[model samples]
Target: MNKPANHDERMAKMTFGSVYPHYVIKVEKKGRSKAELHEVITWLTGFDDEKIESLINDKVTFEQFFEQANLHPNAPSIKGMICGYRIEEIDNPLTQKVRYLDKLVDELAKGRKMEKILRTE
Candidate 1:
């Protein structure tokens, strides 16, 4: 009496990995509010931008460093993390084009393969 999660095992336990390689870092917390979403995901996964400004200038909050990173739920209040890379490889966006802050950053910056950036319409 416990079987519930089924959709790809609840999306691999919240976007951790079935493959490894998902890097999407679109953080715009509306009005800034001292924005520090885990230093914008360690500066878009490249890291070492002075260690994301010395770990977000020493305040550290974006839910205590992204709650150990690797997140999911890009809707019901917005979430989409893997803030380092994994959930199936990174850096996409229909190979590159679609703009206008891109619909959900092109669905988490083009994983699920983007499919011409989700039909762009």
Candidate 2:
């Protein structure tokens, strides 16, 4: 009955705030706005602007961030590869959710329309 190894440790050690700046830079370089990035994140994780600000300011770990988030109903609609992994095929639920966000941001950075990224179209 031993717990799994450092999977949680790795995920927990990554603070969302630590990564936010990179995301901003990536999208901005491609002529996208920070507001669009925020919108995609909020849509996926169900965190509002205020809550997201608080989470970033607090340096919350990915674990805590996902724990508090009420994932959107359409999250499963997000699919495709990110960082070489097929998001929908990831077996770990937490890992899949993380990759889902990454995929969305990648799409945004690539200049995909918000409606398409959100799967609303």
Candidate 3:
């Protein structure tokens, strides 16, 4: 039987701009800087400052946002749970990408060292 649209499905349809404010709020509440959040996003998506700004200004959907992104090679190294789901194990590729971003932001908000968050050698 067909299932109802889940959060990921609904989220994919939503604009990244629409969701960005919430991310900013979440990190800011934890004392993380907006620059840090943007840094992480740029690291993961390979979106330069101008690209991200344009995407946000254009109100691109998550589906479109990721479609246009040049995901980092180490992005797969970002494995863990977020919102109760194992990001690495997510069956839907798009959902996995979205959760990967979420997990990174969560780590930043939790005060994880940037080196560890980026999984740098």
Candidate 4:
């Protein structure tokens, strides 16, 4: 049986696997934490959730998972060894996460305030 188009769309909509293919991520040039860097970068890649699940389930290799992903792109401000995404333009996952967290927190605060009012009434 063939999966529905929705399956692909669902996958496309997923954030864990959705990588910002065109962002520039630069870690400290002198950082020697390859393992840490790899771990951090993996989550930001598209299909991150799927890839992470596969890693846990033993379905794919790390290289294959992030095959299209890139390291931090070069930054013009500083002059030193640098690495980041190599795409023309991409959104940064960190920024997205921050925005999401902020929104979530605001929602929770509103909920809490509502709860307090309800409790008093």
Candidate 5:
């Protein structure tokens, strides 16, 4: 499906908190733990468990969530398709960052090793 022209704008306004639960469910149903999910998130965004909880409680938008993030230096290595978009090819920086997180979560759910998912290996 074709994304709307305002896709980036719409995604920017989406609350990270609203999407957090779905991520948890997706990973957990595949036998991954919530802690593992948090690890992936931390690897990408550098937010620890406490900070993540706070962000979830505060219902921060994706834009705000990323603004405060110390994005991992290795993030650019996260290449592939997510939500029908080639993450490396995305022109908008924010959208690419969001897709990076989605790709990490997808890898985790697919049972990839943590080191590989984090690009440590």
Candidate 6:
């Protein structure tokens, strides 16, 4: 899965803040609450509401966001297709993490139970 030469750089430069609203809208349109979205994010990144707000306010890049994240150990369990790529097959670690978030948000929008979305047995 060789990405374009500039893809990684572009993704690195894209601010998490820029994409936050889209995630919010995606879930909200499906009758999901913002709290649920935050919970999913916290489960993956270990960032609480305050830190997430700060990151959004500061316009942190995905690179910086993931760099500061204490990524959940269960993150590897997240699998499926997102944005035309398979999560487990993504060659780029950063891209994979980004897609993992996308996949979780997609699940939430699809009304998957929180327990399953969190991958808790």
lDDT (0 to 1) per candidate = 0.31, 0.86, 0.89, 0.32, 0.95, 0.95
Local error of candidate 1 at residue 16 (angstroms): 2.1
Candidate 4, which segments miss by more than 4 Å at Cα? 1-43, 68-121
Candidate 5 overall lDDT versus native: 0.95
Candidate 2: tens digits of C-alpha lDDT, residues 74-109 = 999888777777778777788778888888989999
Q: With candidate 2 superimposed using the best TM-score fit, by how many Å does residue 66's alpha carbon deviate from the native?
A: 0.6
Residue 70 CA displacement from its true place in model 2, Å: 1.1
Superposed by TM-score, candidate 3 places the C-alpha of residue 3 at a distance from the truth, in angstroms, of: 8.7
Local accuracy of candidate 6 as per-residue lDDT tens digits, 1-120 = 456889878888899999999999999999999999999999999999999999999999999999999999999999988888889998889988999999999999999999999999
TM-scores for all candidates? 0.19, 0.90, 0.91, 0.20, 0.97, 0.96
Query: Residue by residue across 4-75, what tens digits does model 5's lDDT show?
Result: 999999999999999999999999999999999999999899999999999999999999999999999999
Error of 5 at 100 (Å): 0.4
lDDT of 3 by residue, 22-70 (tens): 8999999999999999999999999987898899999999999999999
Best of the two (4, 5) by TM-score? 5
Mind giving the per-residue lDDT tens digits that candidate 4 earns over 1-121? 2335454334334353233221112222333233333333442343354445554355433334334444223211112111232222224433333233223223233333423212222
38 in model 3: Cα distance from truth in Å?
A: 1.0
Which candidate number maximizes TM-score? 5
Better of 2 and 6 by lDDT: 6
Q: lDDT tens digits, residues 41-79, model 1?
A: 332333444544554455443333344333322212222
